[model samples]
Target chain A: MLCFINGEIKNINEGSIGLKDLALQRGYGVFDYARTFNRKLFHFEDHLERFRRSAKELRLDLNYTNAQITENAETLLKGSDLKNPALRLILTGGYIYSPSGNFNPNFIMIAEELPTYPEENYTHGVKLLTYEYQRELPHVKSINYLNDIRLDPLRREKNVFDILYYFQNGITECPRNNFFVFINDVLITPKDFLLHGVTRKVVLEMANKYWKVEERKLELAELNSADEAFITSTTKSIMPVTVIDDKKIGNGTVGMKTQKLIKLFNDYVLQFSR
Target chain B: MLCFINGEIKNINEGSIGLKDLALQRGYGVFDYARTFNRKLFHFEDHLERFRRSAKELRLDLNYTNAQITENAETLLKGSDLKNPALRLILTGGYIYSPSGNFNPNFIMIAEELPTYPEENYTHGVKLLTYEYQRELPHVKSINYLNDIRLDPLRREKNVFDILYYFQNGITECPRNNFFVFINDVLITPKDFLLHGVTRKVVLEMANKYWKVEERKLELAELNSADEAFITSTTKSIMPVTVIDDKKIGNGTVGMKTQKLIKLFNDYVLQFSR
Candidate 1:
């Protein structure tokens, strides 16, 4: 594996950070994940935009600009044997905290083999467990995932793919995916209360051209009446949610809308991969 | 400075973690801060207990046993020239994430100079700004401080010492301190909606011996009628809040109860330091 640490390329085994990095000390950092298809990045600009936004939100200084990050990533990928790679860009609060002092941000980019999902997961869909919680900062993509990581045991025991978070009355996003449902032919998902996912934006934009897309509060009650449900993420693209908390969603099979969206997403990716 | 990374002691400048350390990658880690008084750690057991509890809450494996951690801290302190140092014990999720795979947790202990607060901060007390925000997984002492760091500008502009967090109905806690209010001669602090700080536990236990202590819900309205309010933490100990949101807290000076509690705390620390 190849990685970029502070503008220098190194083997994954050699990629290390100082103990005083604020990301390790106080979880003060922002990161964005992007994936490559056939050696080309999909929605690279979108990911960079979100990365910059998340960094700004956390008040973390990005020592390198977006162009520099992209250029470095491209250089790393070009020197690697990866065809379909997963890349993570991290900007940390830096090594050591001086009382009311300037910080030197740590910039790291890691490229790894794309995670391979079983074909059954996309075909038969996946189960989800409901968790009652909200992220600290919904808009910013910080490195904090204690809530998500802590639920791994329960998630594995229940044989679920991810945990869908809900705050009291409304359903928020999943651990790493954005929730969407087709309620009475109008595609609906929670807005403002969740991280705006890159793939979710793509699906929403493409879906908006064909279907009525509403970005608003999605009540938990509405899930029971949904015609179909699915989740969008950088890795999964659009994954159908067949079972949610023991309740079968839309006859427990992948819905037509979900299939259609997946097809559209695949087409979009393929068209841009070249 | 000397520090413990994993099981090895290294110079602070040479202490480093892999880029894949979950603490850096996902901010999935728990930490506890303890301060030394005259080179003797105060409430060392309490801090360790909390550290273990937090690691348990996060399911982070401490490859080293509690005894090992204690021994390492003692060795690090003995070898260092730090007097009245601030020590932090961190247990990260691991170096990588795998599906249904065990992770090798990264254990780190860092010792640094103790922060010095102005005498006026403890004598006249400090001002506070109120923000409506609640921490996620408040019981666990994770490195997630996004909300607190995000409020840095507001805190600096107002020249306030800290930001007190409140939910819809009542005050929860300050950014890094536990909130306490003396209402009608009874000392009250939020029971379960915040992290139970070591110093807070000490103060509560000591205060219970002298005054009425109620560990229950404290309504936002009670702040206005309260005789006094203060915040507690390992570093700050019992710091009184003179002004909260521009409103004077008990005549805009350190209340007698706060001063009394501070004196009790100082005496207790002095007794244990030797």
Candidate 2:
């Protein structure tokens, strides 16, 4: 895979960053990723907007403008052979701070093989584990996933696909995905203190047209009692959540609403590509 | 400076990591750094123990054992030209997860110049800015300084050396330093939901000999009214904190207790190095 790092395109294997890059040294960076369908970026502009916002929030100075990044991504995508790819925009706080105590932000646009989940996961849905931890600075997409990574063993042990985070405040979000649930025909997703994912935004818009879309605080008990549940992400799209912890949602099978939303999301993607 | 990546020692400038490294991609990594005084590591074993515990808590499979890392540090220090330097041990979650979903941890031991703070920062003391952000995993020392780095502008604008973190629960700690306060000759520091800093541990042991050391919840009001306050870290040692936010700490001059502790810490360091 070809990656654009510091205005130069290099092979994925050759894509190396200075060990002193703030992203690695302090995890001081922001990133946003968007997947490609039929070799075209899905909601490219929306993702870039969020990417720029994340950098701004973290006070990261991007070497390249959003327009330049988009143009570079287009060029890189044209030469890429992967039918579906995930393009990630990374902006680091830079190498060693200069004498002036300023950072030279390092920007990189890399393409990776789009992760392919099992067909059974989409058909039969996936189980989720519950964790009582809230991400720090949930609004910004910073490179801090220690809590999520530490929970990997528990995730594997529980045979779950992802973990849902809910603190005393309320249900926040998943490690990498935006969570939502359907209760009595009302589609609810957490309103604040969470990343406003592009997919979640699109899902909200789509669901609003057909269902009662509400953005508010959702508790674990409300989630367990949800008629149907699902998570949205660039890669996961709208995948159903059949079980959370030991509690089964509805009848332990994918509900009609979840299936309908998944189909609707797929159709929306097709329309987006066109 | 010569550094060690895995087993190979390379020039610090030439040392680099793949973009796919989990440390950069997902911030899945653990790191511990200790400063060398007069070409000798101060509290080497303590830092390593904390480093190992951090890696274990995060489930990071370090490529090298603690003994191997110590040996590499010694070798790297031998080849180094600097007198006083900081050695940082970084263990990343490694390359992309395999098909079976496993990470090959990447280990790197790098040396950098020790940060030289103004002499007045110790004698006249340093001012601190207070932030209301709590770290995600306070126990594990992950490469997540997003909250700290984000406060750089505020730190500079306020002309403070570092930012102190306080939540609804009370004063937690500083971004990089462990906070302490002296109330009526009793030394108190936050006991839980904070990193067990190596310097803090050593300071606690040393302070226990001369003063009453109590590890408990430290309220902001108590800190504001403290007789004297200080912060402990690998690099900062026992630097005095004269001002927090807009409140002046005990007449805003280095207190006798703080000075004595600093002297005690320096004397201990000299003895350790000998």
Which candidate number maximizes DockQ? Answer: 1
Candidate 1 per-residue lDDT over residues A1-274, each given as its tens digit = 7899987999988989888888888898999999988788888999998998888876666767778888889888877777678899899989755535556889889987777778888899989888888888888898888778778888889989999999978998997899999988899999967899989888988999889999999888888998888988888888888999999988999999889999998998889886
- A14, model 1: CA deviation in Å? 1.3
Worst window of 10 by summed lDDT in candidate 2 chain B? B96-105
**Model 2, position B262: C-alpha lDDT score:** 89
In order, candidate lDDTs are 0.86, 0.85
Runs with alpha carbons beyond 4 Å of true place in candidate 1? A96-101
Cα miss at B221, model 1 (Å)? 0.9
Judge candidate 1 at residue A183 and give its lDDT: 81
Q: Going through the candidates in order, what is the number of backbone clashes in each?
A: 1, 0
After superposition on all CA atoms, what RMSD does each candidate show versus the true structure? 1.7, 2.0
Write model 2 residue lDDT over A1-274, tens digit each, in one string: 8899999988878989988888888888889898888778888889888888898897767767667888899877776677687798888888866433777888888887788888888888889988888788889998777777777778878889999998885998998999999999999999888899999999999899999899999987787569988898999888888888878888989899989888888898788778
